[model samples]
Target: MKISPSELISVLAQFNPWWRGGHIAGLPAWKRAAWHELNQWVTQPPVHRAVLLSGARQVGKTTLLLQCIEDLLQQGVPAANILYVTFDHPMLKLGGIDAVLAAWREREPRAEGIEYLFLDEAQFIRDWGTWVKHQIDFVKDRRIVFTGSATPLLEADQESGVGRWHAIRITTLSFYEYLHIKQLALPELPPLRSLRHLFDWTAPDFYRVTELAAPYTGHFHEYLVRGGFPQTAQIESVAQAQRLLREDIIDKVLKRDMTALFGVRRILDLEHTFLYLCMHDGGLLDMTDLCSNLQVKRPTAQHFIELLEATHLIYRLPPFGYGKDVLRARYKVYLADAAISSAVLLKGKNILDDPTALGVATETAVFRHLFARYYAQQVRFTYWRGKQEREVDVVAEVGGQIVPFEVKYRTQHTGVRELKGLMELCQQKNISRGYVVTKALDDFGLLAGTPEGINIMRLPAPLLCYWMGEAELHGVVE
Candidate 1:
């Protein structure tokens, strides 16, 4: 069915209320960390390339775009020059980009100056990459910003968008952003430059920081269950929030987006694979066991895993080693967010009661923070396992320096003996510092008298996450 130009223009006008002398309303003033990165690209792009924001659904991508539009209006930019349209709308979906733009131009023929176009859910448009590339190459004095819930821009249609667009991933809110959104009045502490700087902190510094962050302890557990999605983070009821997360974020990606974008025919198999990952979050992947338990072939299970990762539902961490050894080692998987596992497995506040479950969630949270913090630096994140089944949870290779972190989120006090994996890795690699994430606030300090003069700092998981989140928000470098 061919859609008429008048029909498309009506949809565009509704989306861009400012075009009709109205304003964007009912949006929060606060912004995510990605806002800083995005603002730079929109206002003063270093190069003349379009910007693409990609992430899982309900991560507030649309909200961020709306915020940008509001800012531009305030700057006194002509409202007609800006076009905000989302393909999610059925009418717009029927009217492809060319038809929509033609309608827009028909309504406003003054296309003489720079035009800013914000396209939402652009993956629905067929050959969107080629279309965007053509705009970048042929069109002059025009800027384009698009958003997608999937990674089609980088995967299937990447060749067309190779150098035409800059990709920025918008992740779930961090603990710091979560606190701000919840409007918690916890006292702010001095910023710690980076995770590496904690090694140089004195005894008093550690004690002072821990005391300052004590007020956050009561809320950290709730944050774990609620997760970082802005929409669900503020819901008063934890169960209701988790339910919404499952329905809105998890289910949409698994049931609808997977089938539409990736040709996933066996939805049951994909759902079961995700559920299994949730049950064993932060565990090694055993392909044979997973295939047998799911009653699917090896290739089918592998394809499901790939689809999950592509949709940003899970993260896969390879083992730390050279070529052949790394190839043979099993990959450890973690949900993109801790709250996801909790939502899927129906673990609410009761999750905190189960130490084992709590530990897994905490480790998953820690990995997410580390991944977000160092991802921009191109740092390689992998786990290490030695003889006797000793293992380090996360080993970050930064500028050829190996920093090992082991999560021991337990009530009892941890000694050097329990951190055998961290200690052994430090000794073998001649690294001077390591970290152990603990459960109790009182367990925050350095473990002295270790072999090879290694300094292992035991930090509470909540405080560590808070500081890491803070550092990321501030863009503090080591």
Candidate 2:
């Protein structure tokens, strides 16, 4: 169903006669702090053909696009010039693309000007990327932005000669972005060399945690458990938050979005498998063992895992393969958001109390939280392991350098024994600095460098800023 450019505007005009619906459509005010990517996107000179945004579930793709659409329409692009389609609604039978153009033509039967096209959950239309390419070639005057979490919509554009597509990957709100929403951190700040270090896991030991007890520790702890997905931030009741994310989010990913994208059957088995994953949320993969548990062939189990990964509901972090990379070690798997892990179980404290399940959960939580914040630029985060019996929890490389860090439950000290092992690992890998980030401090902020240069820091899980890399301090440091 191909919609002519004129028809797209008319259909959209019904939804927003004055280009005012998205902002005034009884929608929640966009809450996350300035997404660093979008901040860079809107200002940077546009290069790729179409601006494409993709990400995990509930990362606010639809919300952000609506916000951008409202602004562009108000800026005076002809309503018809802007083409908006969503595979979720406007069913393919009713009008789909062709119907959209009919509506646009009805609205402004005879008008011609610069046009914009915006789409939501775009994977519904068959071959939407190729369809989009056809439309793009036909209408040289339109600017398009499409949002979808499915790998199809995300990957299709890349496959179909996507030379003109500008890609954006949205992710759940970060701890820093959450703080921004609560109005906890100021929008701008003076040049502070210490602030940047405080944000990284390998933060210099300059700040402390007791400094935050007066008004913030409890708040931060709650964030640690629930994560900063948009709905979690708005819902005050813990139980309500859990229910919403499970039915509305996780279910949608497994049933609606993923099924449509991957064309999967045996969804119930997949559901069971996912629940098993929730139970072992951050555990490493063992196909033979998982096959016995799921009563499926190893290939089937592997297929299920990869399918979960394809739609972003889950991710498998490959073990830090030493350069020899013998047989590429098994990966540790985790849900993309911690909120899911927290929601799937009734015992909130289980993650901390049960060491086996909890360690992986805690590690998974930190990876998602930190990766969600800076996976794009100025950061190259990877896990580490070697043939030797040592491992560093998180290893990040920035500006051609490596920073290794270990996560420990005790905050009262750096747990030197744990770090002593990591220090050896770091030296072996030629990575610098072994950091122990913990909950043992009595201050509201970070701890700077220890005298020996192995940056040690005590940090409460949720509130510490994530100014990662030197973006937080442009020229003062890097």
Q: All models: lDDT?
A: 0.87, 0.60
State model 1's lDDT. Answer: 0.87
Q: State each candidate's clash count.
A: 0, 33
Q: What TM-score, computed on C-alpha atoms, does each candidate reach?
A: 0.97, 0.82
TM value for model 2: 0.82
| Clash count in backbone of candidate 1 | 0
Q: Which candidate achieves the best TM-score against the true structure?
A: 1
lDDT of 2 by residue, 131-185 (tens): 7777667766656667675466656667664665656666666655565556564
Residue 455 alpha-carbon offset, candidate 2, angstroms: 4.5
What's the distance in Å from true for residue 127, model 1?
Answer: 0.6
TM-score of 1: 0.97
> What CA root-mean-square deviation does each model show from the true structure?
1.4, 4.6
Error of 2 at 473 (Å): 14
